[model samples]
Target: MDRVKGKTAIVTGGATGLGFAIARRLEQEGAKVIITDVDVTRGKEAAGEIGGLFKQQDVASENQWISLIEQVRGEFGKLDILVNNAGISGPVQNADPESTSTDDWERIHKVNGLGVFLGCKHAIDLMRQSGGGSIINMSSIAALVATPFITAYGSSKAGVAQFTRSVALYCAQSGSKIRCNSVHPGQIRTEMHDSLLDETAELMGASRDDVENDFKSRIPMGYFGEPVEIANMVLFLASDEARYITGGKFIVDGGMELGG
Candidate 1:
């Protein structure tokens, strides 16, 4: 808990799933966390549970980010960590690569890729003024491997990986104290996965349980990862424990891409 003592953090999409888990872990580590999510109800609940503040903000919206960062700066004085965890696999219609349209590509790029860019853009300035901070971007194993159906998602996450490195070097070149890193998780058990499993099951005319196991079979771990595992990694990166680490890509996959 002393690792992040006296620190303040902003976690986007922190209402549930991996984001919420990360928020909880940061709070446990003695950081005052502000959870931003589009779902006001869950966001408030999560913040209350974590003893943090809740703000409704869609990460894909640049104007919303401006207001959000301003509010965090005013209330918290300085931001120590920023987690760009909010994202989608793309709209339902465009989830399939063959069916993906230009508009779909653009939308996913805006949320999954551009959102990280904007977060780093605004947070780096604040972190610089405050001396330094850590930025953790939520990528996916798909970014490093083939994703036939989720082509847009895979592409967006690939952009995230490169953008993370670019921003990390930019900070280093500018002598800013901010550190940038990326994390990739494989098939975590979240609502997002549940929905995907349901969709795949329907398409395959199979039970959700059967489809879930089929998905798990591909993982060397023989099970889907829990959100808290990913959260734990984020906590480590966001805390002083990772002071010497920067510009790194940490994979939390359960050996899902072992040979790849």
Candidate 2:
């Protein structure tokens, strides 16, 4: 309760799944949250539910990023936290390096890679004006491991992880109090995960249950993770309790990354 009281936060892709959960958590902890997503209707509904604000945004657009930060500055007078959670995995098939087309690769990178970069870039400027803040970029286990099936998404997330470190170092070296870190979630039970399951099932000509079981078997924990679990980590990072933590990679992956 009140972990981030009086703070102002912007959560990208907050209309659903992990994003929505993160926004709700921040709002619940007393932050003034703004939920941004391309899905205007859902985004508004989500914001209303959480007693926060909503902004329609295509994160890939630099103009929109600029406008969003300006809006935050005008309304809140300062921005304290940013969760760069918006990203796209694209179609499961044709995602491999050999099968992926240039268009498909670029599309995934545009949203997953460039979006986070832009968010961090603009958020830093606003945060620096207001005595600095925390930036949490959502990476994934795919970034840590080889994801031959999702080459573009995996590569984009890997870029996010590395870029987060760079952002943290730059802010620190420049004497900015801003902190940057990446959160990598593994097999979270979200709509995106369900969709991936369905697609993988089809691609492998296997039953959904079999595909799901196969995925579960890969995890040492033997189950999917919940959204709130990831949200809690973000909350911790957003709070002053983690003031000394920067340029870190927090893996909330249920030990899946350890690889049984």
- Can you write out model 1's per-residue Cα lDDT over 134-245, one digit (the tens) per residue? 9999999989988678789899999999999999899988999888999999989899988888878887798988998888889898888899999999999998889888
lDDT of 2 by residue, 116-223 (tens): 999998899889998989999999999998967889999999999999999999999998899999999999999999999999999999999999999999999899
Write down the lDDT of every candidate, Cα atoms only.
0.89, 0.95
Give the 10-residue window scoring lowest on summed lDDT in candidate 2. Answer: 251-260
Error of 2 at 63 (Å): 0.5
TM-score of each: 0.96, 0.99
Candidate 2 residue pairs in clash (backbone atoms < 3 Å) = none
Model 2 residue runs over 4 Å out of place are none
Q: What is the lDDT of residue 225 in candidate 1?
A: 89
